[model samples]
Target: MATHLITGAGSGIGAAVARRLHDRGDELVLVARDAGRARELAERFPGAGTLVADLAEPDRVSWALGHQTVPDRIDSLLHVAGVVDLGRIGELTTKTWHHQLNVNLIAPAELTRLFLPQLRAAKGHVVFVNSGAGLTAHAEWGAYAASKHGLKALADSLRNEEHAAGVRVTSVYPGRTASPMQAKVHSQEGKEYDPARWIDPESVATAILTAIDLPRDAEINDLTVRPGR
Candidate 1:
């Protein structure tokens, strides 16, 4: 069974990914901000380990990863942990922008940098859960769009750097998924967005797992999944 490490495994797309991977009998290392949720997930999968990490706090995140012992070789690294904030240029404060960028962009890149050696050893794949906003910006989504755009660029650059090293990278862009982040955005905007009409988190998880399961010689650099409206 392949071994994978997933960040933000506590809820939404991240939680769904963990559940599906566990069902497939893979060895899982789940990381999240909530210890209780992480523990609850670990209880469902035998041999699964949980690491409570606040990705925004790089020091704590680094200490958590550095102090832990995981499988020497990880077949896949899913950088799914992220936070979203909705605001126009002036409505968003520096703190909110920094917080969103910290979680959505910096954290994943830093984690990948810290774990690149192990991934190289295993010739593993790196999967990034980006957003459609990463490709095209939308109104009232300044910070989120900016952060996701930066994240996409990071993933693209990493894919190029790791191609020769036998490490594959895939960035997934899902448009309006049914996530807590989506709900928050809708609420903040007072928009009548239907969560049920959005892309399913489970389907996105399947896409991620499929990308990792692809033949080592094959590389899917980017994938975009949107609801069939």
Candidate 2:
């Protein structure tokens, strides 16, 4: 089994992906900002490891990626950590915008760079869990959309640069998944979206596994997995 490193593994899509990979016998390094949650998840999975640090903090992110050794050779890097801020242009706060960009774009890019040697050594795959909002702009989702778009660009550029080295990149755009974040968004507006009708986190995680497990000759460059009506 391959060794995989997943960011944002304390919960949601990241946690689901970690569990799936662990169940398939792949070794995992799960990173998240929440230390307690990270420890809980690490405990749940046998042979899994955890790292806790705030991805938005440059020093913390660097320390987290630099100081910690991968449990094994990393064959896949899954970037699942992100932050979303919904507001009209004027409603956006400086902190909110910064947090959105730092967590959603910068941290993942930094982690990818830090792990480049390991990925190159293993000829691994890099997967970015972006959002449909990255491709299409929404009125109140300026910061969130912008950060995701930046992430998409980074993923594509990295794929092109690493293709000759047998390092592949795949960007998965999942729309409105049933997640706690989504619940928070919906609750804030007092509008209930059918959670069951949204895409399942486990399903998205499975798609990531498929992309990584495929032969080197094949690359699932970009994939959009949304809820089917």
Candidate 3:
């Protein structure tokens, strides 16, 4: 059974991916923001491991993981945790920018760095669950887009740097998916939230699984998922 260390496993696309992997009998190490969430995920995926590390505060991640039992070789490291708050450039605050950047960009980078040795040892893959914002920026998406754009750059750079080690890197850009985040986005936009109108998290999870499950002779560098409706 391959081992996977995944972030943002509590809900939405992350949860969907985690469920699929768990059902397939893969070993799972889930990262949670706190002890409470760690317990929650542990219960959700019985027998799966949990690590307590807050992605919101990127600086503390290294220290936090240092105190835990990290796996030596994981087949894949999934970066799926993210936070988004929308506001026009003029109204955006430094706090908002920092929070989004820390969670969406810096934390993933840090996690990747911490687990790279394991990834290299296993000839593993790194998957970044980015947003459509990573590809195109729109009004009121300045801060989130900037962070996701940086995430894209991070994945590109990592893929180049790790190719010789047989470590694969992929960035999955998913357009508005039906999740709490989408609901929050709709509320921020003063629009009615409708889950049926968006892409299902399970669909995106399937795409992620497909990328990771490809034969060793090939690699899928990037995937963009859109609403089918």
Candidate 4:
């Protein structure tokens, strides 16, 4: 069984992906801000490990990594942790912008950097759980969009740099999904929350698994999933 490490695995898309991998008998390392939730997930899956961490803080990430007994080779590293704080340019605070970028971009980059040797050794895959905001900017999504755009660039660059090393990197752009984060976005927009109108987290997880299950001779560089209306 391959080992897969997933960030933000306590809830939403991250949790869905963890469940999918676990059901496939893959060993799991689940990282999340909620220690209780992460532990609960670990209990449900035999041989699963959990790391509680706030990805926004650099020191916390370092501590979390130090505490985990990472295998010498990892089959997949999935960056799924993110924050969505919406504000227009006029109302945006420096703290909010920095927080978004730190959690959404910097933390993932550092984690990937740390795991690169393991990934290369196993000829593994790296999946970035990006967003539709990364592809198209909206009025109140400037900060999030900027971070995701940076993520897109990071994924592209990593794919190029790691191709020779047998490491595959994919950027997944998923549309609005039913999650606590989307509920907050709906509240901010003054709109009714409609789960039917949103994409399902499981569907996105399936797309990720599809990328992971591809033949080592091939790779899926980018995947975009949108709700059918």
Candidate 5:
């Protein structure tokens, strides 16, 4: 079974992906900021290991990944951790921008750099859970949009730099999903949250798994999922 490391594995899309992978009998290294949640998931999936770290803090993120006991060669690294802090440029602050950028972009870049050896050895795939915000800027989503755009750039650069080493990078751009983060977005918009208007996290997880399951010779550079209505 291939070993996969997943960040933000406690809830939302991350948790869904972990569940899907577990059901497929793949080994998992689940990382989340909440120790309790991570432990609960580990209990549910007896074969999975857990790592607790807040991706917003770079030093703490480094420490957690540094100390975690993972296999020497990981078959996949799924970057599912992220934050959605919405604000227009006029209302945005340095702290808010930095916090979002650190968690959404910098942390994943660091983790990818740290795991390069194992990824190279296994010729593994790197999946970035990006958003539609990464593609186009919205009126009040300046900070979030900026970070996601940078994340897209990061994935593009990694794909180009690592192709010769047999490392594949895929960016999954999921439109507004029925997630806690999306609920918060709807709250900010002063609108009732409608699950029917959003994509399901499990559906996105299935897309990710499909990308991972592709033949080694072929790679899906990008996959975008959007709500039907």
Candidate 6:
């Protein structure tokens, strides 16, 4: 069974992907934000490993992981955990920008750096579950979009840097999906939230698994999953 380390396994697309992988008998190392959440995910997956590290506090990730036991062989590192607080450039505070950037970008970079040794050993894959906001900036998405845009740059640079080591990197950009995050976004926009109007989380999970399950001969560099509607 292939071993994978995944963040954001608690809900939304992360939960969907984790369930799919777990049902297939793959080994999972899930990253939870706290001891309580770790216990919750551990019970949910029933044999999956859990690591507790607050992605919102990127600066302390290294010290947090130093005290834990990371998987010795990580076949894939899934950067799925993210945070977003939407606001225009003129209205957004430094705290808002810092929170989004720390969780969505810096934390992933730090996790990837920490796990590179195992990833290189296994010639592994790193998947970044990015957003459509990563591609385009809108009126109220300045800070969040900036972080995601920076994430694209990070993934691109990592792909080039690790190609020689036989490691693969992929960035998945999904349009607004029917997730808790989507509900929050809709509330922020003062709009009605309709789950059916958006792409299913399961569909995004399928897209992710498809890319990672590809043969060693081919690598999917970027995948954009838009809503069919």
Q: Rate the local accuracy (lDDT) of all candidates.
A: 0.86, 0.85, 0.96, 0.89, 0.90, 0.95
Leading candidate by lDDT: 3
**Pairs that clash in candidate 5:** none
Q: What is the lDDT of candidate 5?
A: 0.90
Q: Report the Cα RMSD per candidate.
A: 1.5, 1.5, 0.5, 1.4, 1.3, 0.5
Misplaced by over 4 Å in model 6 are none
Local error of candidate 5 at residue 37 (angstroms): 3.3
Question: Candidate 3 regions off by >4 Å?
Answer: none
Candidate 4 structure quality by residue, lDDT tens digits, 135-175: 99989999999999999999999999999999999999999
Clashing pairs in 1: none
- Candidate 2 lDDT, 67-142, residue by residue in tens: 7655548889999988776889898899999999999998888888888999998999999999999899988889
Cα deviation of 139 in candidate 5 (Å)? 0.7
Candidate 2 backbone collisions, by pair: none
lDDT of 1: 0.86
Alpha carbon lDDT of residue 40, candidate 3? 95
Residues forming the 10-long window of minimal summed lDDT in candidate 4: 58-67
Candidate 4 residue-wise lDDT at 34: 67
- Put down candidate 6 lDDT per residue, 71-109, tens digits, no spaces: 999999999888778777989999999999999999999
Which of the two, 1 or 4, has more TM-score? 4
Best-to-worst lDDT order = 3, 6, 5, 4, 1, 2
Over 26-85, each residue of candidate 3 has an lDDT whose tens digit, in order, gives 999999999999999999999999999999899999999999998877999999989999
Location of the lowest summed lDDT over 10 successive residues in candidate 2: 63-72
Q: At residue 6, give the lDDT of candidate 5.
A: 94
Q: Tens digit of lDDT per residue, candidate 5, span 1-229?
A: 8999998777789889999999989999987777787778789788898877778886577778677675687999999988887777998899999899999999899889888999999999999999999999989999999899999999999999999999999999999898888898999888999887899999999999999999987999999999978
